[model samples]
Target: MSPRQYEDDDAESLPDSRFLLPQLRDADTEDVEKYQRGGLHPVHLGDIYDGRYRVVHKLGAGGFSTVWLARDDTEHRWVALKIVVADYSTSVSTKSQLSCHAASRCASDAVFGFVLERRHFTLDGPNGRYLCLVLPVLGPSASDLSKGIYSRITPSLSRRASYQATRSLADLHAQGLCHGDVTTANILFGLLNIDRYTESDVYRLFGAPETAPLETESGETPGPEAPKYIVKSLNFLSSIESVISQDVRLIDFHQSFLISLPPEQMLGTPAEFLAPEVAVGLKASPASDVWALRCSIFRVRSGEGPFSGFEVTSPVDLLRIVIQTLGEMPSSWGDTLFDYYGQPTKEPTKGSPLEPVVETGRVRLEDRVWKEDKKKPYPPCLSDTIRKPTATKINNSYIDGYSYETDELLEALPKISENEAALLYDLLSKIFVYDAQKRPSAREVLSHPWFHMGEL
Candidate 1:
């Protein structure tokens, strides 16, 4: 049976737990001042907005916005209502972010592209106004699913999800855009049974005043009051059959940026998922997104990132792992000193507006390559080194004698077929190239043989 059918038949028997939305924490002094400046107002179940959307429950919250599962009386369906905290919308950067989001909506209709589109409307509050974005209610995020499902995701499922994600990224890249943050949390499943009520009932209660009354089998308008649908603890992901047919969608464009413009901020997730170029103070590009995408694919399949489980968990260690696993950084690029925030600088001076310069431990070019006898041996130039890599004089210092083998990082990877494993490794290496210029574009990666492994 369809998920919606099950929801319709069982909704009445389910306990009314819609009010279980966790109470919003009290706003801090700064947030209070922002709200006083017309930022946002408290929302609760049953609260009406713009005389149309009725709040049903909270969906989730982020650093700058809160999403609620709201019923759009005009459309007579469920929609996700995202409200940017009032104060943030006032910032110039936030305006640019919203513009990027608006552009993403245009690409959502493209074949294979899956950006969460926003509806038109700016909701006004008494103290602080808000930029209201109405979107389709989607299921759990990829991160949530990954945690629950763990390593059970099959190769076919991985290929399909990755294929869709690549197409989405390629679409963005074609438009000179970059999803600055492409973590699993921003990817969600497109599931059913999100809303419990039938459209007929919704029309009867909130349909247009001038429209004809909603017709029933008995040819009569229902009572003015209808029982509200309750929000229950949904195990939707668990309920979904282990099939490779399902698709994923990309959401959250607040961090998206245009590649043609100068980057305004350092973006992307922490150590494990960050791109090599991003780690070494370079502007984000489509290739950076590719890097994150590769990391995400690995995490979804293996349950952890390449550099996640090390005893020494620091940015320096991450860099070390990258060098060991991916080979030496380009000679010229390797020696370049970046400010703490990964921005290139002439000199590594302390307190020099650099966030925290990457610690380029004393790397010797000779050490980067493995001997001919070693597994995964380096090229013939293994003996070509003259000087130690100059370390940035920042708070964090790199270890002089530190070294690693590529197998150290690959050991935790899941065991697959020899051909499948080789294809996967080759694809990852291409995207994770030390030089961003050499990294394959989303379209190029999409055309790789790994994705066409029969199941596709």
Candidate 2:
């Protein structure tokens, strides 16, 4: 069965143990009951894998696998050991082959380093056989770094990071491969010479693993299949400054596929980054990847995504936001109609003012005319009026769509200069088009002036 189908099948076969298992207070840890057969293999600190790798700390976990920071005794280096759940263990060879192909294609260049699978092995456990892939240790993801007070990085740094990320996608596309899922979470910062640090140094730098004991509501000790304690993922790297300066590594190719052979269904992509075409049940392509890349760039520069704030229960909800934000969908989509009024009259064509327009003079709050018809939310164009009192007037002619909470949410983003913001807006507009064919290629995105405006 395909991975997509396998997910459905697994869900159907697995018993719902919500009432059986004890409620875990730490939301960061993985589900404790997922320690049975065909689920997560129980792994703990100091556990030896394949007689070579020694698990030291937990990196993170996902729906299908768990990543651990391990020390390779034979190679004497730090490596990320990604252990795939037994249910999907059969596909490890295919995943490994794809990684090798990508690595070989970009072997000559070190700038756009594709994720390479260093080595892989199989292990027997109470949960069943597990496929373990060893890879180079990477730092925090772009999404993790771009949060809290450090939401927005320096413009130069943002430019440099965006250029490298687009270049990596260009290389992959040139090789006829598409990173089906291209979100900020998949782009990680590369740690320089990570193996040089001793185990003690690693603990001191990233802090020791934070763990809590697992328990059963029935007051019985958990079986051997379950881990004794749950280890919290070390989401952020301690060296913030160093992390921002390092180059980026595009990781996670599980959803990736060759352009010649597209999957029937695309799985694992974040709802906010799903492209219009893909969200409408169309097959993923290089063009779709470019669309997702544009969204990722927007989020990297600003704290939040373009289509955020709405509770996205499914891809259709996200598609609605896309139509609401970017205007109506193309006729080619066929019957995917959504009612939206007061859309911007001017499309994001060349020389158009797509960025938020702010007026020159300030208007006092009391003197300003508030729309008495409170039933209809104010248009996005007028959002700046409330945020910046000085910039009072907004040309409603350019307004797009009825009131959007996303605009207000965007107002809370870390401030960037007017010039830089305009440049970035222009770049996003060029790629955020509804037609996939009209969107710029990954290579063309590299040549965009936004990436060249700053020192990067």
Best candidate according to lDDT: 2
Q: After superposition, how far is residue 114 of candidate 1 from its true place, in Å?
A: 2.6
Give lDDT per model, in order: 0.56, 0.69
| Shift in Å, residue 319, candidate 2 | 1.1
Error of 1 at 391 (Å): 48
Q: Write the per-residue lDDT of candidate 2 for residues 1-456, one digit (tens) a residue.
A: 244565687789977662244333333566666788898898999999999999998888887889999999998988999998898887756856775686577637733556767888898999899989998888767776553222344456667777888988888888878888899888877766777789887777677888777776665777878888788887443432232235787888878888899888645588778887876667789999998888888877765568644555456567667766788777766443221211112232211112222322322223423333322332333231112221222332222222352355335444688988888889999888878888889998788888898666
Candidate 2 wrongly placed segments (more than 4 Å)? 1-14, 18-27, 110-112, 148-150, 239-245, 336-414
Candidate 1 at residue 407, lDDT? 34
| Deviation in Å, model 2, residue 437 alpha carbon | 0.9
Model 1 scores a C-alpha lDDT of 0.56
Point out where model 1 deviates above 4 Å: 1-41, 90-112, 124-127, 148-151, 193-235, 238-245, 310-317, 333-415
* lDDT for position 366 in model 1: 34
For model 2, give the 10-residue run with minimal summed lDDT: 384-393
